[model samples]
Target: MSYELQAVIGAEAVLRKVAAQQPGAVVVPLRQGFALIPMTDELFDSATDGGRGDGLRFSKLPGGFERVLADWSTAGPLGYVEAGYAGGVGTQRAALWADGDLAIGPMFVDVNEPFPAIGSPISQVLAHLGATRRRRDPDEFVAVGLDRCRDTEAWLAVDRSVLPEVARSRR
Candidate 1:
């Protein structure tokens, strides 16, 4: 029942543009006009040669991510959002870029530690992207259907056969 994700959020057309430009990229539609490009392990590996961090890396983003996002900002704003949860403990992180500038956070929320405000980091970013909160939903994250799957890889429906075998905690 736990979930995890790392993705770039933007308008569907904008995300499609980025997906077309970047090999192996795919857009997962969300509520509203916004969609997300899930940063799957394969994509991450190809971008960073097995996800190496020795050369260069952004604090929250992977290496060279900002440059790619900046180059693709012509269409619209882009936001990077990541989240993970298991055993009732989790964390979420989010950041936004628009017009080639940082618009909002690189914000982080600790869900089970000291706890955070009602609106989580991912929800806040979605709100900034124009995702409205419905009356019944607890937050924008669930409203966007992000809770539909456990991870970005699932969102993309990635072919597990092509991925390297690794033990994942599904408990």
Candidate 2:
């Protein structure tokens, strides 16, 4: 089944703090982690227009970024740690920052574009493919130029930078 992630409870205060610090960003929760989506005119205008197919639940992409937190949520394991959206007709991309130490993703686009031609990595992380362990650097975080995790079109954009800070900030 295809699943979408949602926000978490009790994370509102921290999300608000992060939002205040981030200015144009809105905090969203993935089953695996959290996302920091930017508040742009294009984002607000494009989400509810049925650009994606039917049953595409955009409950996470609220019309307003500053709306009050609600208490309803789906009970399940989080699929992504965070996510980023690229709003457009041809490339309505959803870059999902998935959770777990070994997860690699964030580059889920509406259209399939060639890799290594669209993005740059935030940092590098250790990856395990079956029994092999190696370091996919710089571009690991960026999906376009990423070498590993090529099959899923997912990159490790958020592995190094955000996860640590999120952990520290929680405590």
In order of appearance, the predictions have TM-scores of 0.80, 0.23
Candidate 2 Cα outliers beyond 4 Å, as residue runs: 1-16, 19-59, 66-108, 120-134, 137-171
Estimate, for each residue in 1-171, the C-alpha lDDT of model 1 and write its tens digit.
688888888877789877887776778766655678888766675555333333322223557666677667767888888888887688877877788777787777776664357577788888888777678778887776677678777877744233221112111
State, as a TM-score between 0 and 1, how close model 2 is to the true structure.
0.23
lDDT (Cα, tens digit) per residue for candidate 2, span 34-135: 333333334444433433222223334444221212111121111212223334222222212222221343333443443344342122211211111125
lDDT of each: 0.70, 0.29
In model 1, where is the ten-residue run with the lowest total lDDT?
162-171
